[model samples]
Target: MDGAIWASAYGCQGKAVASSAFGRPSGELQARADSPTPAGIRQRSGAEMIMGQGAVPIIVGGEVVGACGVGGGPSEDAEACAAG
Candidate 1:
């Protein structure tokens, strides 16, 4: 599957944004407002999370601007896991 697609689908946007702002590669963020944990929803969060690997932030000019998470699911694990 596509890592970007999964990340987009699993609410990885926040993580990506945080990564970009913090200049860190490893980080966690809630996908939804009702989410119980910011890290993720646990086993019920879906294959994208249950089997997910890691999230990597995209930094620009010493600041996080976005992120690219890899692994943890078929869609995002095509190549390798990008840990944040």
Candidate 2:
């Protein structure tokens, strides 16, 4: 199944980031940025793993300067399986 791209840009307080879905990232990253739900957090799995689901946090002087992310969607039971 096709997945949606979710991203976030962080700047001290943090915010959403905008990026193309063409690039493949990590689901965990994206879920944290987009959906905070249990399902969103545990989506994607295996070779069929969904793309754009990870986060990149910017740190400066032991502080979180910013962060970026990408991912979300309704695929198969991969997320459920992964969660289990």
Candidate 3:
């Protein structure tokens, strides 16, 4: 999958965000809301979520082939970068 992370002090956070993308259709914000667990989906999945944005499915031919995660600051900027 094509993705990029900018200036994250926690290296794993970037990977976590990217990987989390594949698990859901909505971004992190919605992910938390849709979580069936109380500890939250990320915690259940064994990753600490620092931010709530960026990361989306790369759909092709009506199927999700991969994902794109542009994690940096706010969800909007990251999302825009990913979309860009």
Pick by TM-score: which candidate is best? Answer: 3
Ranking by TM-score: 3, 1, 2
Lowest-sum lDDT 10-residue window in model 3: 9-18
What lDDT would each prediction earn against the true structure? 0.43, 0.31, 0.52
Q: Could you tell me how far off, in angstroms, the CA of residue 78 lies in candidate 2 after the best superposition? A: 18
Cα lDDT tens digits for candidate 2, 1-84: 134333312211121121112222234344444454423433431122223334344446866544444224332232332223
TM-score of each: 0.36, 0.24, 0.51
| Model 1 misplaced regions, further than 4 Å | 2-8, 27-53, 71-84
Name the TM-score of candidate 1: 0.36
Per-residue lDDT for 33 in model 2?
43
Better of 2 and 3 by TM-score: 3
Per-residue CA lDDT of model 3 for 1-84, tens digit only, reads 134354543533543354344544235554454455523655665654433456555677877666556554666676666667
Error of 1 at 84 (Å): 13
**Tens digit of per-residue lDDT, candidate 1, span 13-73:** 4334434433454333323323555334433444233222245666568666666754435
Error of 2 at 77 (Å): 21
Top lDDT prediction, candidate number: 3
